[model samples]
Target: MERFTSGAHEFLIPMVFYSLFCLVLTVNVAGAVSIQDDCHERRCNNHEPPVRFPFRLQDQQPPHCGYPHPGFQLSCSENKQTLLKLPRSMKLLVKRIDYDARWINLYDPSRCLWRQLLDLNLSTFPFVDEIEPAASYTLLNCSSQDEALYKGNRVDCLSTSASQIIAFRSDGYAYLDNLLNCSMIGNISAPISPYFFRFRLKWNKPDCGDCEAQGKGCRLKTNSTEDQTECFYIPKHRISVRERLMIAGIVLGSLILAMIFIAVGWRYYSEKKKKEGLLKIEMFLEDYRAFKPSRYSFADVKRITNHFKDKLGQGGYGTVFKGRLSTDILVAVKVLNNFKGNGEEFINEVGSMGRIHHVNVARLVGFCADGYDRALVYEYLPNESLEKFIFAARGKDRSLSWERLHDIALGVAKGIEYLHQGCEQRILHFDIKPHNILLDHNFTPKISDFGLAKLCSKDQSSISMTTARGTMGYIAPEVLSRNFGNVSYKSDVYSFGMLLLEMVGGRKNIDDTVENTSQVYFPEWAYNCLDKGEELGIRIEDEEQTETAKKLTIVGLWCIQWYPVDRPSMKDVVQMLEGDLHVLTMPPNPFASTDPTKMGATIPRKPVNRELPTIPEIE
Candidate 1:
């Protein structure tokens, strides 16, 4: 019996050895299969919410070893002492993991309570299955009025200190009230198992009907219940692979097309700007070439003008210096003051006068257009402007005879009429006061200073303006109001009328004070004297002087009707000065008194006949 038992033990030992060998082989095979199935191209578990491709773990190690998305890649830290390797920016702490639910409860220390997580794109990672739809919370001191909207559904808050259960469907994570007031919420704390809650998941197919009813397609279930299964309502409008590729191709093509358009537009704009600049330069050169005024360097100008020794007159634009170009040729050199680097007035005067050649208009001999220095050279006139003679209170030596005054008036009228009708473009002399009308040695009037002159085509009766551009009292009423007709050649007529009045008054038309008498406008005072058959206080003592002054005053009054249409043209103005006085009547007072002090003195004057004169046709 002992020999038989020994032999059986020997047989049992061989059987045990063979069974152990088979078991080792089976374990090896299982391990190899797990490695082949789970191991990805690279290891990538340590990213943020989304993990990238080419990184995974062996099947035996667990699916959580990789990220949830394809592009979020992770690399092993050089210091391999840490348990879970992660990026420097990821503020995450894994509190618990449920094996049955295949879910992890994590706390993000960087989370914001009211902020939404949808802005973060989580699809790049692979290991992170999904992000939870709702944030976890606990009801503490929250009042009943406090409500939370979760997954498009509003949930009311219960009483304070009540235990609350908030479950997130996307990651199948459940949160519980450990201590209502002391619960970890938002980015407050990193939770451990003692305060953490986990979920228990069951294998359940997603109910796609609810998603379909809500116009959405079914996604993988993250959380499931006994009766109702969990699902993500994905939109049905997802692009197909081919459509996605086509879209990408279209986007690239569109970008190329946009680039082409941009390039074309830029080239066109650049060329256009270049052409405009070149055109401006050419025009400036052409207009300014012939009359280049001997390129007087600052020193030459100083020498020619004798360092401004012989000043002819002082005016708003600048001072005029009488300089001698040669012993035989004397010139009037006007040196303009700087107007904040705006040489527009200087350019306009030079440009306009250079293009014009008329007996009545002053000729532009030459000009300078240096950086800050501007000068205009003209043939010197022996006599000064009409204002120095006619309007001076004490300068009787310079006073003109009635015949000379008439000739001067006729010459000035012809000049203005020429400006209106003769040139290719009509020139409106905005500053038409006596100061601008100069007299030569023969007492012939020549209109000077085209600085404020505006050039317009003959057919254009009116011009639009942004601002009032003329002497204050001389500006037409129509220029100030839109209710009046378009500002036309009529505007110049109005200025001429004012000028005629000033010529007759031998003083400014608007001046109210005279010696010691109460304030009185020259026009009103003259009209009163004429209507009452009183003397005009003529400085000259002759019957002819009396007749000339009366005729001049009447003609002046006839010209200065308030409305531009009521005033006479320059043609009629000359005729009235030359024609007999008996045919003329008192013109209607256009500028009737507006001041209360003069209201009682106001008297209406009758209008003159409109179509009475036939002066020479303007050529």
Candidate 2:
């Protein structure tokens, strides 16, 4: 009897469990779906507002999650901002949404709501402003002198130096007597709120007020063909002992599958990205190997640089380290950073330098493009850059003789000329300053750092440039503004001209530390001094040295003319620098202008040099 009782109890328990599992599987096979399965509230991002009925996030929620009508859709921007596209292609950012109030606050993505209001046509949209009465406002373009009249009401962004825009209520236009100077540009009818640019919009269609009153959620009917909605009781789903076990198994299995997929996908993506980068470098090297620059391995680079022991210098591109191939042969190895603008700077340096061989141009000994590591091996210059010697202190013995300075200047100009015309295609050294000029033991200047260089056809007079390039003070006026002239080889000439002025004055072209505010800009002060025929040096006894200073100043001023056409080419500059001092003529005052303020007493006076007794020659 005891054995029979135990056996029967075990069989009954197994049967009950098996029967329940069969029933649940049959229910699932019958296509029974929960009413509130996918229509639940969802958000694009945690910071963004949750969306439900009458509005839905397009890609995130199903079609039935939102009302089946126009203007009820929302999307997430790449930056995770909630976005709503209004009529006439006006896309605005959804700042906030109040579900109970049935209103949403919207602001323009461009941060210029007035510009959107200019072309706004909201008749096609479902939302409307019910609080503030829509009023017609006349946009007025008035002279900047009348900015005080509009004060806080002025659109600062739309306003320029010559004119300003003011929004005036159209009804009060006839009453205002001081609007004669303001010309009406256009008229827009929008809600006038104290918030100015931002406004609130409310929707009235498919209202869910009754559901809120009953403390229940509302949604459209699942099976009904019509646009019928019903208030639903928010069910608290309670899991029984058996149901809890099933749910636990399903969740654990899903998590395992998800983790496996993620691991495999991440590994595949990493390998593909690495392969693509290495393939790109290999393809480039295949075409560039003919240039005869040796390619080194990563291990070889580390060995040559002595594991990056001796630090040389660092800049925007990367860090340089003093390295050696042998005890007798030395190399300056520049270990490039991973963020090489996607290898743009590295490619520019290698591609431009590989095609040229000159006495004044730095030699590219070898390079390493292994996996993620990159380095450029260059002929190490014992004297480092010309910047170290040129801007030496007042009493320092680093200063060079006038003749030596002339030779360095000529060498740099010749190197620039070679880059422009000596190559197969013209290579424009967008950045040309003393910092880039490397010097050997004999102080022979070699142009280095071709990261900012650009290559174009030799006959292409003006290269198309969407954005400005080069150092701040040395950038050509034409590069900053097309009004001056097109950007060409003449751009480099302007940079060289700035370098020349800095060399001659023994100070920066723009020095704000001087006691005299007027003479802060050295180029203008030097031009004024040369124009007045004043002595540039206070204690220079040699006449030849003074002449040399004057010649360099004149050449620099001529090269920095406001217009590119007015500035001499590098070829002409070379001739002027090498010619006799008497043959050189005074350049037109670059600072001279037709503007009254410049011509008046506000113009900068002569610079006072009390630190140095002599004009320091550039090394």
lDDT per prediction?
0.57, 0.76
Worst 10 residues of 2 by lDDT: 610-619
What are the per-residue Cα lDDT tens digits for candidate 2 across 429-463?
A: 89999899999999999999876777777766767
* Cα lDDT of model 1 by residue, 1-619, tens digit: 3564476466557655655655565565445434322332332243422221112322323444333332222333334211222333342333333322344444433343112231233222223323332233322222223224222221222223343323233333232332233332332111121122232112112223455456543333344333233334332344558655655654565566557557655766776799899997997686568444454666666777889999999888788899887888787888878344476755665566676666778867778777787787777888879888877774768677776776777788788888888777777787777888888878788888765677777765566666676777777766665344456566777776667767766777666556634325676677777888888875657888777778878877776555556677777877887788778888875545644346223433433322221122121
- Worst 10-residue lDDT window, candidate 1: 187-196
Give the candidate number with the greatest lDDT.
Answer: 2
Clashing pairs in 2: none
Show where candidate 2 strays beyond 4 Å: 1-291, 338-349, 593-619
